[model samples]
Target: MSKYDIALERIDAAHKDDPTTITINTTTLPYELHYAQQMTLYLERLDPNASELLRLAIRAQHLRRWEIPRSSYPATKIGYHSWRGALQREQAALVEKICVESGYTEAEAARIGALVRKADLRKGDPDTQTLEDVACLVFLDDQFDKFEKDLGDEDKIVDILRKTWGKMSEAGRSEALKIKLSERGECVGTEGFGWLSVK
Candidate 1:
């Protein structure tokens, strides 16, 4: 197999260790593995010509995420940000190691690491921005319903969604409009993004 295939296999093997399980239709998968798949799926839809490095970065976006549970941190907003930042760094380092072990040069591994960490997102790095877009798309497509139900506060959910909306590029937002949302999800999206007119 190719180096890309080797690295991807290694990444998925690591993802398989996640204890959290999610059943989609008749197939069951580790939550992180499923999330990684979703990230790749959205990345392909968003950028079909995405580079190999970008593909590897997207595949390992949440590499071994369960290692750091949210409860390990405080419950406040600062805590939430801290937890997320920690996850990004941890995943980036882990993926970088995998890249190197699978025969990638240090520079290539570092580029994958940067994409995993979403470095330079605010500075308008195209690949980093696309990674962010795929993440938002995955959340909206796969996790939004469950998340909304758990939160159970319409106003708060809309507030959170507005923040999510602000993160996406125009292309991401446009693709988001195509996702099949539940009634509640649609309502929340409409409220959060007044321009979202997804029929």
Candidate 2:
């Protein structure tokens, strides 16, 4: 959503270490290959709750390409658009599939899917409280290890969730428990992006 360097520098100063915010952050690392690594670090550092969701949404917004400026890309515009659509479907499908598996009504699943998509867009909007907002950031050093890694044992998710939640704000902690509960005592599958892990 940002085009200028000044705006990005401001965001970078705020969330450079928290890479999930890297997407909306118009900084030096915006186009870096290690962007995923930073993103994973940010997510792993935060629990999958409102605060984390807020960060995810910000990253998603950056990932969502409204249009690829012709100057920046001479060709492959159509292909890029198609690729973006594929990713969008993949994101929506994950929510829909999870909702259905959780026994959500058809209408409910649809609503949640829509909500999830909208949430992503919200992060890109300038008027909103960004992922860099103090509300979403709670510093707990070495707190990232609690969350399950893609290659980690799934059983570790439970302990990770517990430890991760412990590092969050009260509201974030509450939502973290809710997500784990929704998993039905199970763990989120470590597939695809796998919490945006770098390796």
Candidate 3:
């Protein structure tokens, strides 16, 4: 197999350890593995010609995420941000190791690590933007309905969706509009928030 294939295999191996399993279309999959697959699918839709490094970064987006649960930190917003930052750092390091093991040069591996951490996200790098867009698309397409139902707070759901929407590029937002959200999801950002009319 190629180096890319080897690296991808290693990433999926790590994801396979996730204890959290979710059933989708009658197939049970480790949650992070499923999430990674969704990220790749959306990346293909958003940028079919995505580079090797970006593809590897996307595949390892949530590498071994269950190792650090949200409950490990406080329930405050600061805690959430802290936990997310930690996850990004950890995932980046882990994927960098995998890239090197799969025969990538140190520089290439480090580049993939930066992509995983979204280090240039604020700089408007096209690859980083595509990664962010894929992440948002996955959340909306694969997780939003269940998340909305579980939260059971329309206001909170809208707030969360608004924040998620704010992170996407115009292409991402356009793709999000095509997702078939649940009835409740369809109502979000449409009542009065003219800035985010997903419907």
Task: Tell me, by lDDT, which candidate is best.
Answer: 1
Which numbered prediction scores highest in TM-score against the true structure? 1
How would you order the candidates by TM-score, starting with the best?
1, 3, 2
Model 1 vs. true fold: TM: 0.96
Model 3 C-alpha lDDT per residue in residues 44-74, reported as the tens digit of each score: 8999999999999999999999998999999
Model 3 scores a TM of 0.95
Angstrom error of the Cα, residue 18, model 3: value is: 0.6
Off by over 4 Å in 3: 192-199
List model 2 lDDT by residue over 1-199, tens digit each: 3222332333333333433323344554433223423443445445344432344333433232323332343357686666655655654555455445545556655544444355343445321223322222321222233333443665565444444443444443432332322232232422321322211
Candidate 1 lDDT tens digits, 117-183: 8888989999999999999999988998999999998888888788888999999989988888898
**Residues forming the 10-long window of minimal summed lDDT in candidate 2:** 134-143
- Stretches of candidate 2 off by over 4 Å are 1-75, 104-108, 115-199
Model 2 clash pairs? Answer: none
lDDT of 1: 0.91
